[model samples]
Target: MTLLALAGCSSPDGGSQASPTITTTAAQATTAASKPGSRIFGLSDNQTAALDYLTTLEDRHAPFVSDDRLLALHRGGEICVDLDNGMSFSDLVASWKPELREDGAKLYVRAAVEKLCQDNRSKVPA
Candidate 1:
């Protein structure tokens, strides 16, 4: 009886638990996707440039900015941009390529940025 119980416990299908490894890349991708429109908010060139500078500084000196500053910049940029000019979320997503690349934020950053732009645009006066 004890031998049978041990055998059952040791069975490959019975005791093997599938462990999903979450790598930094995977986590970053998940974070980017889950947040949707959270990194870029369709800012104008001036606003984009200023935020870019701030983000660069944060990236160089303050890693914490990676977590919160980017979101704040996105919000501020959305407020600064004149959305009545017909800018779409797709445009903002495309525009974020440089920043995303610089930050190593994952490929989905573009999609997230675009989603954010779209979400912000949705709230604008149409």
Candidate 2:
């Protein structure tokens, strides 16, 4: 869900602006908790670690990166994971659509997800 939230927030333009801050707000996490089917609530230890890793990367690179580049990296990561897991990107996204209903919140989360995906690309199966 965090990935979906982040992926949704990215801009298509190559402009530089502040990346959205992710609040550990109750509503955001609540939305995930309300949805039994979502993968975002109370993230597994591994997921939290991955999210932290990506967030660190985003913090380091956001000032120098374009939204478009970040989006591309996110997409690339999605493609790799989809291929590795035999899951369609659309379907994967669809599952999170209900939880990631707000586009603005999504914009904030995209850059982080992109960096995470980019870094994890090598884990994709051949």
Candidate 3:
């Protein structure tokens, strides 16, 4: 979870900023998420939930193409931060999705707001 938060603090120019590396096996991610306050792999429940939500998006044919798991999660965190800064749904949809189609963009935005920025859910239009 710390890694997820750390990875997002990068240069806006998309320069050669070094990414934080987190090395853990699949079993470690699962085990770390299951135990409360147990950050063996540094994956908290909220972090794991966001990651799992992304998996569902992929299942629904809205997959994001990042081989590194943290990259996807970091992007999700960025979406949440945008919402924190009062970026509306329409604006988020327009700015957040880079290579994704309309449907995929909606999925990504909705999933990020739901899992990562739940407090702002009611602010979004249904």
Considering every candidate listed, which one attains the maximal TM-score? 3
- Candidate 3, residues 46-88: lDDT per residue as tens digits? 5456456656565666665654555566666666667767888
How many backbone clashes does every candidate have?
1, 5, 1
lDDT of 1 by residue, 16-110 (tens): 54343323354553443234333334232233333443445344442233455445445444532523344554454456545554333322332
Worst 10 residues of 3 by lDDT: 36-45
Model 2 alpha-carbon drift over 4 Å, by segment: 1-83, 102-113, 119-126
Error of 1 at 112 (Å): 10
Please give the lDDT score for candidate 1. Answer: 0.38
Rank order (by TM-score, best first): 3, 2, 1
- Sort the candidates on lDDT, descending order: 3, 2, 1
lDDT of each: 0.38, 0.39, 0.60
lDDT of 2 by residue, 19-107 (tens): 55455555544433222233232233124334654555455443213444334334324433443455543454454356443342233
Work out how many backbone clashes candidate 1 has.
1
- Clash count, candidate 2: 5
Off by over 4 Å in 1: 1-71, 74-76, 79-82, 101-126
Question: Using Cα atoms with residue i matched to residue i, what is each candidate's TM-score against the true structure?
Answer: 0.25, 0.25, 0.57
Model 3 earns a TM-score of 0.57
The alpha-carbon deviation from the true structure for residue 86 of candidate 2, after best TM-score superposition, in angstroms, is 2.1
